[model samples]
Target chain A: MTMNKLQKSERFSVVKKILIIITSLFAGFATGVFGGGGGMIIVPILTGLYGLQQTKAHATAIATIFPLCLVSVIFYLTHGGWEWKSGLVVTAGVVVGGIVGALAMKKIPAKWLQPIFYILMIVGGIKMLAQ
Target chain B: MQYLWYIIAGLIGGVIGGMGMGGGTLLIPILTIFLGVEQVEAQLTNLISFLPMAIVAVIIHAKNKRIDFKAMLWVSVPALVTACVGAYFAPRVKSEWLSKGFGAFLTLLGVAMIIKIIVQKIKSKRRANK
Candidate 1:
């Protein structure tokens, strides 16, 4: 999905590009295997490795995850996976909430994003491990 | 009626996810922990559900001119290949072990992120003091 040439003319060396690819491999597989966390991996790569700003990085993350998640959904659906009774309900709510949340991002201060995110990661991590 | 909780679960997870924090990260755990779903099933739900939410979010972001399709290609092409491999193998793994492995991954990443935040905060404070 090539969009208009990136607004800026910045480019990365082959080595850096390769690093992006390798890390994406991790992001892609994580989403496929775990069914989530691709965005977490992808966003850091955009912001840290690629040096995109917060909003752009989040946008690009969705762009990247859209395709990655599509691949996983295909495989999961094909392989004896039809648990959508509850899944549909959740998906429906996610769509409505997603719209508002995406809108809300622009209003939020980026300075606070990292601290909040790290806290979320720690909390989610402990919960998963505890279970 | 019974699904009301599920709806609420999705809503909370979606909002955070929309903020670009990885919806499935929270969503899968929510399903597994609070709603009593199996680990694998929760993962599957997260994956399937993500498709629609991402589409919606992407469109909204696109309209806002937020997405970098160039980056999308750079990262996604290679990721697409391995995603197939991972997806192919995921179902074959034992669910409990898989959950535990993912749990460890989250915990490690969490610890690392917190450490990074602390260091950043300290660095800023030191700069302020100077």
Candidate 2:
């Protein structure tokens, strides 16, 4: 009898282990620097390393960012960096934009998305270099 | 072995981000190309990672009295709200289009930055000559 492919418990186990390692390192250090790139890394890692579906990877990435942002926000607040009014506005916009972006992501083709994302990276990089 | 790479990446990312240069620029490319991660995943990772860095920067700026609560409030509230909206809608949208749109945004931002820098340099030179 062919081993039940769905019952391949080893796959899930491996995925879990990889996820834990990636999440911890990506979230932890990236948080410390107050930067992004972890999101970029997470999705790819989830799909490549953990073999998750692209959609699932994307969802997971979004979920992970929430807590990370929350913690950073808290840290800023404690440091008296919480600009209530501005934070509120940006947060508002981000929340709205984020939702829209997320919704849009589901329908987009990965192939099309990749080039655009890459272009964005190059442009963003050039901008930084200029600065 | 990987820990070393992680530390290095983090350090570089931190310095660039702390300087307000946008770590996503570096992180995204590296993740996609070097790390062999998918583009969407890399972008998501960058977005998620940015939260903490942004928050920290905000805090540092606040401590330095450079936060400009008034300005920050204006910028952040809208940003936050939109971010949520974006996130909520992300699942439904086409990733390819989103990627293209995001790329256009980045390119525009880059061009703007370049122009700004050039203008600043020119103005500084004029002032020095005067």
Candidate 3:
């Protein structure tokens, strides 16, 4: 695919940098505590705030969240969450499936799925909140 | 049987995550609510599982040259500092509180996503009409 040519400035403004830092801090903290979901925060920051396109923002969001997950997982391992059996199983599945999803994302009509996703999340959230 | 469920949950979450939405948001709740995994353990699983997926994704994105590396660096640095601190404190927080907080987070995100999608749909329809 040819690039969209939204070529952002190579230079960063102090204001922009500060905003990025502040939001990143929030994303990182939430990821650490919640153990996942940093991408949600980072994607919008990349797209709406930084002017990247949807696909580019998604890719960059992945790159941004990787280190945060790595760091948080280490702390998790240190702090009594170290059950190798199940974690490894999940990891195996995730590794296999993540690659597939990453490849298929370009082909899928993601717009149709968004509504379902949000509804599911809302139902799941209500259940958890009640429980 | 349980292992199958574990893999299924992981697969579903991974696929969604690889699609760019946060897999952990869905995975954590699935594990805790459906699989009867404890809250902290569910969180841990999400964190561990995402790493490998992220590695693969980064490689793919790198190959496509989609990532903005400079942006990645700037965003990651500050996030790294606070993530470390947050991780350090995570296990110390009560599981109940953590679970509740996550529930709130998920609900808020869901609401926001719905609004965003609606706005997008309206805007797209308007564009098409024009």
- Best candidate (score: DockQ): 3
Chain B TM-scores, listed for every candidate in order, come to 0.83, 0.74, 0.92
Strongest candidate by TM-score: 3
lDDT tens per residue, model 2, A39-103: 55444545655566654554444344445445443443333333233223323334343334434
Say which candidate scores most in lDDT: 3
RMSD of each: 5.8, 21.2, 5.1
**Candidate 1, residues A58-112: lDDT per residue as tens digits?**
8888888777777787887787666778889988888777777778878984457
TM-score of 2: 0.46
Q: Compared with the real two-chain complex, what DockQ does model 2 have?
A: 0.05
Off by over 4 Å in 2: A1-131, B1-8, B54-56
Q: State which candidate, 2 or 3, has the greater TM-score.
A: 3
Full candidate order by DockQ, most accurate first? 3, 1, 2
Q: Model 3 chain B, poorest ten-residue lDDT window?
A: B15-24
Candidate 3 residue lDDT tens string, B1-130 = 8999989998988887777667778888988999998888898888888777677778988999999988788778888998998888888898888888889889988998899888988999999999
Q: Model 2 chain B — which ten-residue stretch has the worst lDDT?
A: B70-79
lDDT against the true structure, per candidate, is: 0.78, 0.45, 0.83
Task: Quote the lDDT for A16 in model 3.
Answer: 75
